[model samples]
Target chain A: MGILEVKDVGKRFGGLQALGDVNLSVKENTCHAIIGPNGAGKSTLLNCLVGKLIPDTGSVMFDGQSVLGRSPHEINQMGISRVFQTPEIFGDLTVMENMMIPLFAKRDGSYRLHAIKSVMNERQLREEAEQMLEEVNMLDKRHMHSASMSRGDKRRLEMAMCLIQRPKLLLLDEPTAGMARADTNNTIDLLKEIKEKRDITIAIIEHDMHVVFSLADRITVLAQGTPLVEDAPENIKGHPKVQEAYLGEAH
Target chain B: MFGLDKKDSTLLILVAVLTLLAPFILNPFPSDSGLAQFNAGYPDLMQRFVIFGIFAIGFNILFGLTGYLSFGHAAFLGVGSYSAVWMFKLLSMNILPAIILSVIISGLFALVIGFVSLRRSGIYFSILTLAFAQMSFALAYSVLTPITNGETGLQIALDDPRIFGGAVAADGSIPVTNLFGLEMRSAFDMAVGPWSFTFSAGYYVCAIVMLIAFYLAIRIFRSPFGMMLRAIKSNQTRMNYTGLNPKPYTLAAFVISGMYAGLAGGLMASMDPLAGAERMQWTASGEVVLMTILGGAGTLIGPVLGAGAIKYMENIFSKINDNVLHGWFAFLPDGMEDAVVWILHPFVGKGWHLTLGIIFMLVVIFLPGGLVEGGQRIARAFKGKKAKETSEKATTEPAE
Candidate 1:
C-alpha cells in the first residue's frame, strides 16, 4: 500500500465543480508530481490534502490516518510540511529565527508554552538552525532579516525551514514558480540533493514540465479536476491522452 | 538579575533610580520660586504617574507584541477599582487584600471578555471588546448601582462593616487606606539649599508595584512566548501553518494586559479610596491607547514615557492660566504679548487636549514608531557625526 491514499475525493465551490472523483496514491520514498493546465484543480487537491479545504466526499489518508477534518497545524504535526508557491518566511524575523520556529514545532508539538525561557538561550535549537542554514548555504545570511533576501534566497530559506522538521512527506506547491532559469535549476538540484540525503517522500504540483521531468519519479496528469493518467515519467511523456489534454485537439 | 539581559537590566535600574528619587528629580525648582508650579513632586500627581505607567506597560504586551488593538481595556481597570473599593468596605482598610482581590477579579473578567472577543480578529475583535466595555460602563452606572455605588462612586462610609479592622478611626472619621499601620497619605518633607521635596508613602508603594510590573514585562518580552506573540503579529497565517495556534497566544496576551489595567485601577482606588463609573468610560480606554501609541507602541520604555509625558502635560499645561502665559511672554511688547497668549491660549488650560491632539498627530505622522523611534533617530544622528569626525581625523593623521 502507498503511504498517501486519496479515495474518490470530490469538491465543489458554488456552481463550479472544482474537483470530481479524484483518486491517487503516492508510494513511500518517491517524488510524485501532479501537473495540469490552469484551473485544473491542482491547488484545490493540494489544499484538501493539507486540511485547508475539506473535500465534500472522500478521505485523504496519510499512513492509514484520515487528514480530513484536521487543522493545518494538526496535519503539520502528523509529519506533513508544505512549501508555498510564494515563500512565507517570517519577514520581520532573522533567517535563523525563521528556521528555529519549525524546529521548536517539531520538538514541542503544535502548542507548548515555552514562556519563561529566553529564546536566545535555546542553545540546542540555535545549533540545529545554524546547521540547517549551513546546509542551504545561507549561514552567512543567518543574521540578516528574511525580508531583505532575494526571491531565490527566500525560497531557499523556506525550503530549509520545512526540511528542518524532517517531515515524512514534503509537499511542494509549484516550488519553482516565478523563478529565473538559474534559480529553477538550483531548486531542482536542491531537491535532488535532499532526496539523496534524506528518506523523504515528495508530492509536488507544478505547471513547469521541465521541473516535473527533472525531479518526479512518477507523474500524474490531471485535467479539469480528474486524474487523466498516472504513469512513470517515460510513459507520461508519450501518452496520447496527456498530449491531447495539454495541446488540445488538433482537428 | 531578574531574568533580564544586560540592556533590560540597565533599563530596569534606570526606571528604579528615576522613580525612587522622583521627589528630588521632579522638584527641580525651589519651593518659593515662580517655577515651583511646574514641580510634580506632590503625592496626588506622582501616584498617577506610576499607576498609569503600569497600565501602559501592560497594554504594550498585548498591542505591541501581538498587534491586537483592544479598545475596551479601561473596563478591566474599572472592574478592578470596583472590586478594590468593595474589599475596603467589607474586609479592612489595608491595601494588600484589596489589591490582590482586584487583580484576580479583573483577570477573571478579562478571561471571559478575551474568550469571546478572540473568536473574531482584526476590526471585529476591537468592536466586540468596545461593546463589552460599554455594556460594563452602563451596568456600573445604573444596573449594578448597588455594588458600584452608581454615580457618586463607591467610597468608604462610616457604617461600612470592616471585618478585619474598625470602620472608623478614633477621631470619629472614616478610616484611611493603609499598609500595615502606615497610612497611604503619610509623607516626609525635607528642605535643603532652597529646595523642598515631599515624599509620600502612597507614591512609594505604587512606584514599587510599577517597578515590579516593568521588570516582569521585560522578562516576558525576552521569553519564547513573546516571540510567538510577535510571530502572530507578523503573520497569523504563517503561525498557523507552522503548527502554532495564534488564538490561545493572543488570548493570553490580551488577558495579561487586562490584568495590568486592573492593577492600575486597584492602585488608583487604593491611593484615593474611591471608585467611579467614569473610570471605565471609552475615553479612558482611548487615553491608554493614546499613551501606548504616543510613547512608542512596541518598545519597552515607550509606553511609560508616553504615559508620563501625557500625565505631566495634563498637570502642567492645565495649570497654565492666562496670567501665567502673560508672565512668560512679558518681555514682548504689550500687543505682541496679547497676540502670543491669544495664539497659545486654546492650546493650554482647558485647551490642553488640543495641544495633546496636535502632538499626537505629529508623533503618529512623522514618528510612527512613537517617541522611542524619534529618540533613536536623534541618537543615531549624533553617532553618525561622531563616526564621521573620527574617520576624518584618522585620514588626516595618516597624511600628517
Candidate 2:
C-alpha cells in the first residue's frame, strides 16, 4: 500500500460537481506531480487533501489514518505541510520571527501559554531558525520586515517556513506559478536539495511542464475531474490522451 | 534585567522613575502661580491617569496585537468594579481579596464573551463585543438591580455584616477601603518655597499597580505567546496552515487583557469604594480605544502616554472657564480680547472633547502609527536623515 491513498473521492459545490470519482495513491519518499487543465478540479482535489474542503463521497487516508474529518491545523500536525500558491508569510513580523513560529508549533502542539518566557530565551529554536535561513540563503534578511521583501524572497521564505517544519508529506500548489525562469529554476534546485537531504514525500500541482519534468518522480494526468493516466513522466509525455487534453484537440 | 532586553528594561525604568516622581514632575509650577491651573498633581486625577493607563494597556494587547478590535471591553471593567465592590460589602474592607477576586471573575466573564465574539472576526467581532457590552450595561442598569443597586450604583453600607473587619469604622462612618491599616485616602503634603505637592497614598497604590501591569505587558510583548498574537494580526491563514490554532491564542489574549481591565477596575474601586453601571457604557469603552490609538497602538509605552494626555486635558482644560480665557487675553484691547476668547471658547472648558477630537483626527491622519511615530519623526528630524539605524527601526513593525 502507498503512504497516501484516496478512494473514489467526490466533491460538489452547490449545483456543480467539482470532483467526481477520483482515485489516487502516492508512494512514500517520492515526488508526485498532478498536472491538469484549468477546469479539471486540481485545486478542489488539493483542498480536499489539506482539509480545506470535505469530499462528498470518499475517504482520504494519510499513512494508516483517515484524514477526512481533521481540521487544517490538525492535518498539519499529523506531519503534512502545504505551501500556498501565494507566499503567505507574516507581513508584520521579522523573517527570523516568522521562522520561529512553526518551530514553536512543532514543540508546543496546538496551544501552549509560553507568555512569561521571552522569545530570545528559546536559544535552541533561534539557532534552528537561523540554520534554516542560512540554508535557504535568507540569513541576511533574517531581521528584515517580511512584507516589504520582493516576491521571490517572500516565496523563498515561505518555502523555508514549510521545510523547517520537517513534515513527512509536503504539498505544493503551483509552486512556481508566477515566477520568472531564473526564480523557477532556483525553486526547482531548492526542492531538489530539500528532497535529497530529507526523508520527505512531495505532491505538487503544476501547469509548467518544465518544473514537472525536472522534479516529479511520477506524473498524474487529470482531466475533467478524473485521473486520465498515472505513469512515469517519459510515458506520460508521449501519450496521445495527455497531449489531447492539453491541446484541446479531438481524441 | 527582569527577563527584558536592555531597551525594554530602560523603558520600564523610565516609566518607574516618572510615575514615582510624578508629584514633583507634574507639579512644575508653584501653587499660587497662574500656570498652576495646568498642574495635574492632585490625588483624584492622578489616580485616574494610572487607572486608565492600565485599561488602555490591556486593550492594546487584544486590539493591537491580535488585530481584534473589541468595542465592549468596558463590560469587563464594569464587571470588575461591581465584583470588587461586592467583595468589600460581604468580606473585609481590605483590598487584596477584592482585587484578586475581581481579576478571576473578570477573566471568567471575558472567557464567555470572548468565546462568542471570537467566532466572528474583523468588524463583525467588534459589533458582537459591542452588543454584548450594551447588554451587560442594560442588565447592570435595570434588570440586575437587586445586585447592582440599579441606578444608585453599588456602595459600601453602614449596617452591612463584616465578618473580618468593622461593618462601620470606630468613628461610626462606613469603613473606608484600605491596604491592611493604611487608608487609601491618606496623603502627605510638602511645601518648598512657593511650591506645594501632595503625595497621595491612593495615587501611589494605583501607580504601583500600573507599574506591575506595565511590566507584565512588556513581558507579554517579548514572549513567544506575544509573537503568536502578532502572527494572528499579520495572517491567520498562515498561522492555521503552520499547525498553530489562532482561536485559542486570540482567546487567551482576550482573557489576559480582560484581567488587566479587571485589575484596573478593582484598583479604582479600592481607591473609591463605589461601582456604577455607567462605567460599562460604550462611550467608556471607546475612550480606552482612543487612548490606545492616540498613544500608538502596538508600541510598549504608547497607551500609557495616551491615557495621561487624555486625563490631563479632561481635568485641566475643563477647569478653565471663560474667566481663565479672559485672564490670558487681559492685555489685549477689550474688543480684540473678547473676540479671541470667543474664538477659543469652544475648544476649551466644557468643550475639551472638541480639542481631543481634533487632536485624535490629526494623529490618525498624519501619524497612523500614533503618537510614537510622531515622536520618532521629531527625533529623526533632530538626528538628520543620515541616521540609518533609526530609519531601519522605522522599517520594522511598529509593535514596540
Candidate 3:
C-alpha cells in the first residue's frame, strides 16, 4: 500500500469538471511525478491531497487517515507538506526566522501560546534551523531578509523549510516552474540529493519532462482530468499516449 | 536585564529613566516664564500621556506585528471604563480591582469582537471592527442607557454601596479613586527659584502601569508568538501551508491589544472616575490608529512616542489662543500682527488637528515606517556626516 491513496477522486468547479475520476497512489520512499497537459487536473489532484479542496466523489487517504474535510494546516500536521509554485515564504522574516517556523510547527503542533518565551531562547530549534540552513547552502544568508534574497535562494529556503519538517509526503507543485536553466539544474540536483539521502516520498506535479525523467521513480501521465498512463519513468519515456499529449508539445 | 537582550534591556532602561523623571523632563520651562504654557508636567496631562501611551502600545501589537488594522478597539476601552466605574460603585474605590476588572472585561469584549471581525482580513476586517465599534457606541449611547447612563455618562454615586470602602467621606463628598489610602489626585509640589513642578500621585500610578505595559510589549515583540504574528503578516498562505493556524494567533493579538486598551480606560477612570459612551466612538478608535502609525507601528518605542507627541500637541497647540499670540507678536505692526495671527489661525487652537494632519501626512508620505524610521534616518545621516569629517581630517593631516 502507498503512503497516499487517491481513490477515483472527482471535483467540479461550477459546470466544468476540474478533476474527473483521478486515481493516484504515491508509494513510500519513491519519487512520483504527475505530468500532464494544460487543464489535465494535475494541480487539481494535488490540491485535493493537500485538503485545499474537497473531492466531491472520492476519498484522499494519507496513511489511512482521510484528508478530505480537514483544513490545509491540519493536513500539514498530518505529515503532508506542500511547496507552492511561486515559493510562498514569510517575506518580512529573516531566513533563519523562516526556518524556525516549520520547526516550531513540527514541535508545538498546530498552536502553542508560547507568548512570553523569547524566540532567541529556543536554542534547540535555533541550532536545528541553522543546521537546515547549512544543508540547503543558505547558512551564509541566514541573517538576510527572506524577501530580499534571490528567487533561487528563496526556492532553496522554501524547499529547506519543507524538508525540515520531515513530512511523510512532500507535494511539490512545479518546484522549478519559472526558474532559469541553471537554477533548474541546481534544483534538480538538490531534489536528487534529497531523494538519495532521505526516506521521503515525493509527489510532484510538473510540466518539465527533464525534471520528471531525472528524479521520478514512478510517472503518471494525465490528459483531460484522467490518468492516461501510470508506469515506471523508463516506460513513461516511450509511452506513445504521453508523447502525443504532453512530451510532443514541450520539445 | 529582565530576560531581554542587551539592546532591549537598554531600551527599557531608557524608557524607564524618561518616564520616571517625566516631571523634571517635561517641565523644562519655569512657572514664571511665558513658555510655561508648553510645560506638560501637570498631573492631568501627564496621566493622559501615560494612559494613551499604554493604549497605543497595545494597539501596536496587533496592527504592528500581525498587520491587522482594527477600528473598533475603542469599544474595549469604553467597556473597560464602564466596568471599572461599575467596580468602583459596586465593589471598591481602590484602583487595583477596577484596573484588573477593566483588563478582564475588555479582553472578553475583544474576544467576541475579534472572533467576529477576524473572519475577514485587510479592508474588510477593518470595516468589520469599525462596524462593531459603531454598534457598541450606539448601544452604549441609547440602548444601554441604564447601565452606561446615556449621554451624561456613568458616574460614581453617593448612595452606592462601596463594599470594600466607604460610600461617602465624612465631609459629605464621594471619595476619589485611590491606591489604598493614597489618592490619585494627591501631588507633591516643589519650587526652586522660578521653576516649580507638581508630581501627582495619579501621574506616578499611571506611569508605573504604562511602564509595566511597555515592558510586556517589549517581551511580546521578542517572543516566538510574536514571530508567528509577523509571519502571518508576511504571508498567511505560507503560514497555513506550514501548518500554523493564523486565526487563533491573530485573535490572541486582538484580545491582548483590547485588554491593553481596557487597562488604559481603567486608568483613565481611576484618574477621573467617569465612563462615557464617547470613549468608544469611531473617532476615538481612529486616534489610537493614528498614534500607532505616527509613532512607527512595528517598532517597540514608536507607539509610546506617538501617543506622547499627539497628546503634547493637542494640549500645547490648543492652549495657544489669540491672547498668547498677541503677546508674542506685540512688537509687530498692528496690521502685520493681525495678519500673522489670522494666517496661523487654521493651524492652532481648535484647528490644531490641521497641523497634526499635515505632520501625519508628511510622515506617511516620506517615512512609511513612521517616526521610528525618521529617527533612524536622522541618526544614520549624522553618523555619515561624522565619518566624512573624520575621513577629511585624515586626508588633510597627510597632506599637511
Best by DockQ: 2
Candidate 1's C-alpha runs over 4 A off are A247-251
Q: Write the per-residue lDDT of candidate 2 for residues A1-251, one digit (tens) a residue.
A: 88889999999889888889999999999999999989899999999998999999999999999999899999999989999999888999999999999999999997999999999999999999999999999999999999999999999999899889999899999999899999999999999999899999999999898999999999998988999999999999889889999745434
The superposed Cα distance between candidate 3 and the true structure at residue A199, in angstroms, equals: 0.7
Alpha-carbon shift of residue A200 in model 3 (angstroms): 0.4
TM per candidate: 0.98, 0.97, 0.98
lDDT of 3 by residue, A86-121 (tens): 999999999999999999999998898888989999
Candidate 1 residue B29 C-alpha distance from true site, Å: 1.5
- Clashing residue pairs found in predicted model 2: B299-B400
| Model 3 misplaced regions, further than 4 Å | B390-400
Report RMSD (Å) for each prediction in the order shown: 1.4, 4.3, 1.2
Better of 1 and 2 by DockQ: 2
The order by descending DockQ is 2, 3, 1
Q: Name the lDDT value of residue B292 in candidate 3.
A: 94
